[model samples]
Target: MIEHTVKAFDADIGQLRGLISQMGGLAEDAIAQAMLALQRVDRDHADRVRADDKAIDAIEAEVERLAVRIIALRAPMANDLREVVAALKIAGVVERIGDYAKNIAKRVPLIESEQRIEPVSTLPAMARMASEMVRDALDAFAARDADAAVRVCESDSALDDFYDSIFRTLVTYMVENPKTISQVAHLLFVAKNLERIGDHATNVAEMVYFAATGTQMAERERSARSL
Candidate 1:
């Protein structure tokens, strides 16, 4: 009976991991597609990205239910309990990441600039880096890889750098072309959303590290930004 119970608990954990993986894939796709919509100025694509956020939210609710059930039934302790709790928190974080992508999508129609702005060209690369961090953080969680989680944390700094550069460029552009301030302001929000996504990814990585090692990751120094 003890052996059977152990197997059942293992199966439950496996199922939980599977759900997280599925949710992560959707979140990653949302970021990529939202950026594509921004780059192409496609309202249809942007609308689809916004609509897809519901799917991520649904999965998060499901994860919460499953996690609660596991705690009630399995009475998981130590590492197992940590893993389950981390999944719950990570689900919420990933859902927020999806929301950030949706926020970016919502801004597509607001930007009406016909001329290609310099800052607009740089946003996609920043979005890609943010998306990659999300992917890696999820991978770390799935593998229970502390080193991979640390790498994800390290990548956050680069994303911050990208945001800083984009912020500076947008401010300069707005100063030079006073007529484009409104449109450029929308791009600034989009950049901020991507930066927040990176921060969310780092949050997930920290959770994963704690779940894997049962110890909190040490804080790393970040460059000070005036903005």
Candidate 2:
């Protein structure tokens, strides 16, 4: 009977993992498509991204439901309990990431209205970096790879640096040509959204580390916290 219970517990854990992975895929696609829409100033594409966020939101709800059910039924202990909680937490973070992508897509028409657009050069690069981190962080979580999680934490600094660089450039553009300040400011918000996505990905990595090792990721996790 004990062996049967252990097997059932493992199956529940697998279900939790599968749900998170499916949600991760939706979030990943949303980020990628939203950035593409922003880069091209395509409102149609942006609208699709906005619509897709609802699907991701639905998946998050399911992840939470499965995670909660597992906790009640399996009575998971120690590392197992950590893994279940991490799934819940990561689902929330991924849902917020989808929100950011939706926000970015909503900014599309504003960017499209510019008569003489300055290429939102830095925004795409930042989005790409953030999107990659999101993907890799989810992969680490699925694999329960503490080392990969630490690497994701380490990688956030680069995303921050990209944000800084773009911010400086936009400030200079606004100062030099006061007339474009409005558009430039909007671009800054987009950059900020991308930066926050990177932060959330780092949070996932931290959770992954803790779930896998049954210990805090320690000072190393804090190294990129401010970023």
Candidate 3:
């Protein structure tokens, strides 16, 4: 009976990990499609991405249910408890990442055909950075590497700077070319979506830090803020 219980617990963790990977793949594809839609002004691709968002949302709900069940039924302790807790938090970030992708898809149609603003120069790079961060955070969780997760959190500052730079450039475009206001505004929202995606990655990294080391990076952030 003890052996059976151990096996079942392990199996639950494995299943949760598999679900995390599947959701990650879906998110990656959604971001890719969003970028393609932007660059090519492909409304069809954007629409498809938007349509697929429901599946990601459903998966998130399912993961949450499973995680809750594992906690209640198995009464996981120690590392098992940490793993289940991390799963719940990571699932929320994954869901938000999907929402960001949907936001990008929604923006594609608004700016489909217009004189592209210079603010766009920063967006692709930001999207790439965010996607990379998400992938790295997942890898960190898989390996339970606290250091790698810290790196992901530290990397978020660069993305923040990128977002600020784009914001300034977009405002400049709107000020200089009132005619391009609508197009530049849409670009701003797209950039915001990408920035939010970076935030989601940072959230994942934070969860990983806690899961692996039982330490909250927020303490450091709070100290810095107080200072």
Candidate 4:
């Protein structure tokens, strides 16, 4: 009976991890599709991205249910408890990331410009970096890899640099082309969304590191110092 209980508990944890993986994949795809829609100024594609956010949100709800069940029934302790709690927190973060992507997608139709501005061209790279961080953070969580999580945290700096450059360029463009300010402002919000996605990804990495090592990530302290 004890052996059977142990196996069941492990299976429950496995299922939770699987759900997180699925949710992460959907969130990552949302970011990618949002960027693609932005790049092409495709309102239809952007609408699809916005619609897809519901799927991610549904999975997050499922994860929450499963995680609560595991904690209540198995009464997980130590590493197991940390892992369950991390899943709950990470699911919330991933869902927020999906919302950020949806926010970016919603801006697509609002942006009115005859041609893609110079700053608009630079956003895709930033989005790509943010998406990669989300992917790597999930991978780290799955593998219980604290080092990999730390690496994910480190990558956020580059994403920040991308946002900074795009922000400067957009401000300069707005100053030079006063008429385009309305359109360019949407792009600024898009850049800000991507930057927030990066931050959420880093938050997931921090939770993963804590789950894997039972300690908060040192990078978080360093980041606080810098701020």
Best by TM-score: 4
Residue-by-residue lDDT tens digits, candidate 4, 1-227 = 98998999999999999999999999999998998988888999999999999999999999999999999999999999999999999999999999999999999898856866777888888988999999999999999999999999899899999899899999999999998889999999999999999999999999999999998888687768899
> What's every prediction's RMSD, in angstroms?
2.8, 2.2, 1.8, 1.4
Estimate, for each residue in 1-227, the C-alpha lDDT of model 1 and write its tens digit.
Answer: 99999999999999899999999999999999998999888999999999999999999999999999999999999999999999999999999999999999999999856787767889999999999999999999999999999999998989999999999999999999998899899999999999999999999999999999988886642332322
Q: Write model 3 residue lDDT over 67-148, tens digit each, in one string.
A: 9999999999987799898988898889889989988888877885556656666678888898999988988888888899
Two-way TM-score contest, 1 vs 3, winner: 1
Worst 10 residues of 1 by lDDT: 218-227
Candidate 1 residue 183 Cα shift, in angstroms, is: 0.6
- lDDT (CA) per prediction: 0.93, 0.87, 0.86, 0.93
Model 2 lDDT per residue over 71-165, tens place: 88888899899999999999999999999989989988886664655648667778878988998998998899999998998899999998899
Please report the TM-score between candidate 1 and the true structure: 0.95
Q: Which stretches of candidate 1 lie over 4 Å from their true place?
A: 220-227
Candidate 4 local Cα displacement, residue 112, angstroms: 3.0
| Clashing residue pairs found in predicted model 1 | none
Over 4 Å off in model 2, which ranges? 114-116, 220-227
